[model samples]
Target: MAPHHPEDVGMTAAEQPRQGGKGPRRAVAARDRTRQPTEVRRRLIVDAAVPLIAERGYKSVGVRDVAAAAGVSVGTVTYHFDSVQEVLSEAMVLHIEQYYAALSEAAEHATSGAEALRLLVDALFTEDTDRHWRMWFDFWHAGEQSTDETFARGQADRYTAWHRQIRALAERGVADGEFSGDDLDGFTARFAALADGLALQRLRQAPPLTTQQARHHLNRLIERELVPRSPA
Candidate 1:
């Protein structure tokens, strides 16, 4: 057979081999794809740990338990996170990010300030009741002694984001002839406090308040403040 030139072998101009060249670059790309599963497994481990730490508190949970919850090996969990503290820190960041993202989405879709407030309150309280509340309490306890900057920063960011959203909604209500509050800051602070208090109440009380009761109470509070009243 005649000798085949690089071009005759279907190599493109860019694919032409240089002097002393190594093998194809595609091999490196393929290797990266293979490693992606490890990255995905790491994320799974973190996701699994969020609920576990939320339910059991971070100190009570161990690396092996997270690995087991994630259905991965302990080495895999450690490969992604150095320790339980690291895992919990990362998990808190992820949870806060996701929680805020949902709130943002809800606000974007809401038709009015009242609707936005409703969505915000619902997001704060809506969950699988027992499991969600348990996890939240766990996180509270875990965070008490946590000196992790990332965890603290994430929490502060969440609070700031929430305040901004509530303030924006209050402003929108004023602009749309809905709300007549004199102090946006005071109202927003009160609203947030009410929601947090309600969440804790439901979390601690046996046979926790039904979703309807929770919604009714929140809606009434929001309506009284944000809804337009009929002229007498």
Candidate 2:
């Protein structure tokens, strides 16, 4: 059996007018309905593409496959995104925004630097078996081969934004006396790098380390490295 598309599910084809004078009115209505579905269809395409890219790697998935998975035509996908690179780029941006939004909220509610760090760690590991890490690896692999300048710039911007946030958090820790006033830049870089490294390790290895182990190790490392000593 042929796969079904969204339009095929319930949208009826626009009917021809009985009189020539009425044709223009029907045409306008049809056009409006068609445009209305475009936005909904585009979101569906991105949602479908996420899991496909995560499982098959972005390089392996093609535009046609995304359309099929999204239950839309190839033309529909292209109408919303000029190319697969554009789709993947937008998807990456959406993922990063959603992840950071949650982090931002947690930070606002956190009572201390340690509390913020704990929330961050919990947010990272509390997801569905590190699905974000898998999607991130896929994005990185795709970004390496992409020739699109916009995509490259967006990728750099994401990393820069993340690093900036990490630096700000470290600075706050120092100001609050939870962390030593030692090299903020170094501390932020190391802290961010450790999370990325652990994510990679978990993605590549089987029998993944439990979330508790990750939290315990990270908390201990933060205490030993970042915490300030009391004044004599």
Score every model by TM-score.
0.71, 0.77
Off by over 4 Å in 1: 1-33, 37-41, 127-130, 206-208, 227-232
Model 1 clash pairs?
54-135
Using lDDT as the measure, the top candidate is 2
The number of clashing residue pairs in model 2 is: 0
Angstrom error of the Cα, residue 174, model 1: value is 1.7
Residue-wise C-alpha lDDT for candidate 1, range 52-138, written one tens digit per residue: 876676678888788778755566666667677788767766776786687779887989876777787777666654455565556
Ten contiguous residues with the weakest lDDT in model 2: 8-17
- Per-residue accuracy of model 2 over 1-232 as CA lDDT, tens digit each: 5644434323223533445546533343454345446667677778888777767776788898887787666877876888887776676678777878878788769888767877777777754747878878778877898888888898899888888877777677777777775776776677778787777767666557676766676666677778765865
Q: Supply every candidate's count of residue pairs whose N, Cα or C atoms clash at under 3 angstroms.
A: 1, 0
Clashes of 1: 1
The per-model lDDT (C-alpha) reads 0.69, 0.72
Model 2 misplaced regions, further than 4 Å: 1-32, 37-44, 127-129, 206-208, 229-232
TM-score between candidate 2 and the true structure: 0.77
Give the per-residue Cα lDDT of candidate 1 at 149: 76
